[model samples]
Target: MYLTIPVLVLLVDLSFEKEYLSWKLLTTKVVFGQAVQLRCHLPKQNCCHNYTRSWRGGPDYTLLTLNEKSSNYTKYIEYLDTESRTSVLTIKSFSESEVDIIYQCSYGFSSYEAILQLTRHRYEFHPTESVPVSLSFNGTHMYAKISLEKVFPKPQCYGNTNEKDITKESLKVISKRNGIFYKSMIDFNYMIDPQHCFGLVTITCTVGTSRITIAEQNTSCRKNGSTFHGKHLAQRDSVASNSHDEESNIVGKVLIVLCFHFFNGL
Candidate 1:
């Protein structure tokens, strides 16, 4: 039953400078109610013939050998092939309590370690909090902007306008929390009908099993409204500063002329 459900398995190769050993860590991305597998193996090398392999994990660093198969919430399996040996650790269900567990596969004196970092893949926007989205029309194009908070492992965001995919520019790590969660921003623009700059705008972002979407009919384009929200708002202050600079220069010139006349009088 556990193998029947859809799961995403990601293989990450951890390369080392030592030619005597070749190993990799495989991570399976899973949701809260799902199971996850952490696999460690020596690939394409018969490096395990001389060294004994074992696994250690959990808060107490409990050592697991070939005979130990089940722990509190974990299951361990080790098998051998013609060219390699593999050790797999499976968590029955993933949750907050199962996080921060360090799993390691030890081969003689060398070992590879991986920690369980829980990632929330299917997050829902709370009703009290508003999704940060803004829309504006600049005569020829309509621009939509959104900011997503607390996304981990980065994300791929796609923007669509009227059922067609548009290009999205992203800014990563505008903010971070707890050294893991990050804030991401995306800007999307599309050429609109000159007569009607309104259309359906949608943005969807995915990270692991987590996906977020925002779709709406862009009705913010109206005549005589602010066409650009992020444009310069201090033009008047800039002109005033320039005028003050000119007046200060004229005063300095007059003071210099007065000092010259005073020294001549003396």
Candidate 2:
């Protein structure tokens, strides 16, 4: 007896782009050495005939089909339902070179493009250490400032002394290049009556697991009060939470290998 194997092909309607079609590629701040998954689909359309569904991008013009796993760190999966079809692209381990680049998913003759961007501290092109921390005083209040550029996720800033909480505000500027510009400031009145204490003002911002900190010690305060130390201020402003208006844009660049190999006899 002879056995036959069926090739699992995706039956995509060429007209899937019409009448409530939804196709998008998305991901969060892709950290180096972490896994990332991007989902793509066209809503409200189902076909009975198998067409071509593939992904095009990465090093060596990666062309991946449904259920295919690339030699690199990429893989593709496809799903079908009664009303729509879904395709997902997953990178086993995201890297720095893959940041800020375009990847495409093609169904039949239609395709959509998407780009993945790194958080502030992950992009080697614009190192996070390049930004400087600022500290100053106005004779009445001690002020500390921390600024970061190309930050994708919203940042939380804190100003603290003696490990106690203080007043701090954060701001994020909208931009289209890599991410957003984040700046935070902390203010403390060191001239309280009957007690004057000032020692260290530490400024810090955290986005996901990445954090940046700045501290200035021995600030001018009366020598009679308790010394203020550095601590993360648990505070965020409305500006930082609402500054992301647009997604990062992708440009064609060097190849970061992503291959799609379809499962045989599907």
Candidate 3:
């Protein structure tokens, strides 16, 4: 279920050709939970000052920075190829939320971008124990969010009923990349089953191309003071148990406002 996004290529004119970098392809694509390889060919330069190697994504955020001759990368592996005059980036396994992003390589004065898109497989999309995804209620409405590097194409959420039909809803993508790497946030309004009496609620979260996570937790809606709890999800045996009646959408709409106050005493 991997989906590819079209990439935009930008050109720059250099009077001196020493700072040019070339890409093997316009875009680099990989399936979710898989590895990928990227090559950034470098041009010979006569400058005395050394050029730095770094990876850029989402505005000016730098995902990784290192000397081309470094021994090893912490998360992924990289190597400087002297034979082909190229810099390589290799991801052994991609489990991060931010996979759909524009990744660029910078070596001193030369920089170029290669679109990176990761898609889920047809069957599985849930974040494993290593990566956690949550869908919980914040009193008034249910919000779903995941901690990822980026949410490309953005994720769409939906609700399911006993009849097996699902309805799609809008999902919002939020990012917290200050000037370095991004810790993206994606939230959305959770739709509920109209027949909340006995029918189950299957909450499925999907990014642009494929699924992310799907769960069927027994949650009850509140008419007045109901609370929605979405602890971190587990791939298997994901059960949030409560014997109380399930709350309806009407009852969970009670509104309340508060202020931030520093407590003088415990």
**Candidate with best lDDT:** 1
> Which residue pairs show collisions in model 3?
98-149, 98-150, 125-212, 220-246, 220-247, 221-246, 221-247, 223-251
- After superposition, the stretches of candidate 1 with alpha carbons farther than 4 Å from their true spots are 1-23, 28-36, 42-53, 64-68, 73-84, 92-102, 106-149, 156-158, 163-175, 184-194, 197-199, 206-266
- For candidate 1, the 10 contiguous residues with the lowest summed lDDT are 8-17
TM-score, model 1 to reference? 0.41
Instruction: Tell how far residue 95 is off in model 3, in angstroms.
Output: 11
Pairs that collide in candidate 2 are 8-266, 11-50, 59-256, 59-257, 64-260, 68-261, 158-233, 162-228, 162-229
Model 3's alpha-carbon lDDT is 0.51
lDDT of all the models against the reference?
0.54, 0.48, 0.51
Q: Which is the winner by TM-score between candidate 1 and candidate 2?
A: 2
- Between candidates 2 and 3, the lDDT winner: 3
Candidate 1 on 169-248: residue-level lDDT in tens? 32222334524445665556666654544556666666655566643445555553343432344666688899999999
lDDT of 1 at 151: 53
Per-prediction TM-score to the true structure, in the order listed: 0.41, 0.42, 0.34
Model 2 segments more than 4 A misplaced:
1-22, 28-33, 43-49, 59-61, 64-66, 74-84, 114-158, 162-201, 206-266
Worst 10 residues of 3 by lDDT: 255-264
